[model samples]
Target: MFCLPVAGIGASAYRGWPTRTGDIEICPIQLPGRENRFRAPAHTSMDAFVKDAADALQPYLDKPFGFFGHCFGARLSYGLSVELAARGGPLPQRIFASSCLAPHRGGYFGGGRSGPFTPETTDEEYMEELRHGCELRGEPTPPDELLGLSIQVLRADIALTCGYRPPGPGGTPLNVTTISWTGDTHMRPEEMDEWSAYGDVHQVLLTGDDFTHRSAPADLLQVIADGLPERTGVLTP
Candidate 1:
């Protein structure tokens, strides 16, 4: 399976994941402009980004593979699944999404016309937004230099998410099972239920914040293990 990180982050965001999840090789997708790919320009468009990701993943598609993404990465993973199917590439056996609303749900940051944060948004305001969302934990906030860099990456990420326009009605639903792993403390049951429209839904609600992927990696991995289909060839240790 390939792991995708949330916004303003890269593959390192999934550093806590075990080397392998069951029989699945835990390959984390490192988006550009962060971590090792820091020099690469951040993708500005989701469609173009997903296409590039799909092309880059072609060689790895030899075996049964799947995707796991959180927050901003969730939609990207979904788009990749759709794009692969459309491009006659290997389709995923399953899609694991966390802490994100379904595309049709459509209300972003209170469903505003313009997103809560934009490229022009002041650095101070962006930091405040992060704090208001309770996303900044740990003592000793990042220094201004690092924080400034993070804010730039974050703005680019926000642009991708905010610019995303969900597909219209009557779209083709994926055949693969979709596991919606949401933190019960953060997402409503009803809101998560909307994922069923995408495919066979196996909802896993756990105790944590929106940061379940980070704070409770083990519990989240267990959920994935339990939901792995027999055909997925997940080796139990």
Candidate 2:
């Protein structure tokens, strides 16, 4: 199984979760341009970024596995599911997508997924948007090794976020079970409901202090493990 991190943080955020949850093996997928990979080239478009993640995990697709993504990571997971389907491969047994609404649920803010990054946006202005965005819900700040990389990644991600236009009010159509986190300022409740139209729905509402990532990683994993399709079985799908 794969546990993807939120935007600024890497797979290191899942340190609170078990390496193996019941029958599922947990492997947190790392985003490029963060952690030890700070020096790698960054991706500016959501499509390209998700493709990179799918490519990185292609070697491990020998069997069915669960996938989890948070915030921007969640956005990529949805796209990855679509790509995997297009390839006629074994899809995720379940997809835990948190902190982000289904792609088309909320109307596109910036431009929908069509154009390139915007210019005339200074780095400082971009950083302020991140600060406000992060403050809206709990998300991790960059560590020293990743501080600069985080800024770069967020800027690139914002370009995608600004340009993201969804398929419609309908959610993705992957067969995997879909999990969503509520109380996220980034994604509203009605938007979350749109996710149910996609597949099996499991909503985890994190109100109060738990609304943010720092206060909710453990709870997040628990939700994923407990809500998994099956703890033990033949593992055939």
Candidate 3:
């Protein structure tokens, strides 16, 4: 499975996950402008990023693979899947979209706010939002410097998300599995049912708060394992 991180986070967010679960090998994609790629510029255009990502991920498509994306990463994963399909490239066996609204759903709602956070949003506003999310997840807030960098990346990412508009009427569909947490106040489980519009969707309701997916608990891992094929060998990139 290729794990895609949520907004304002890097692939390191998935470091705690087991490298191999059952017959699946976890591969977390590291986006530019974060973690080890801090010097690189973050992508601000979803279309451009998807196009480039489709090309870059070509080598890794040799074997059967799937995608696991949380929150904003769900949208990114969907975009990449669509792009790859358009290019007649390999497609994921399945997509696990966690804590994310469907593409047709415009804007975002989180931290008691609706609509995407614009570039006009002040630094303090972004920090307060981030702090609130961490507090809700019962996690420690990052240091000032780290928080600052996250805010920078978040601004660009949110722009990409906000600028994105789903295709009209009959958009491309994929094999989607939507996972919703009962305790996730940010994105209600009922709202995620819209994912059915995209493809054959299997809705899963887990018992945990919003950030529970970050921990990679047994139940979550089991859910993922059940969704994948029983093939052996390491899936890369």
Per-model C-alpha RMSD: 3.7, 5.2, 2.3
Which candidate tops lDDT?
3
- lDDT (0-100) at residue 67 of candidate 2? 76
The per-candidate count of clashes, in order, stands at 0, 10, 0
Model 2 C-alpha lDDT per residue in residues 64-90, reported as the tens digit of each score? 677777656666677777777767765
Candidate 3 Cα errors over 4 Å, as ranges: 110-120
Worst 10 residues of 1 by lDDT: 228-237
Against the hidden true structure, what lDDT does model 1 obtain? Answer: 0.70
lDDT of model 1 at residue 21?
62
Worst 10 residues of 2 by lDDT: 107-116
TM-score of each: 0.84, 0.72, 0.92
* Winner by lDDT between candidate 3 and candidate 2: 3
Please say which candidate is ahead in TM-score: 1 or 2: 1
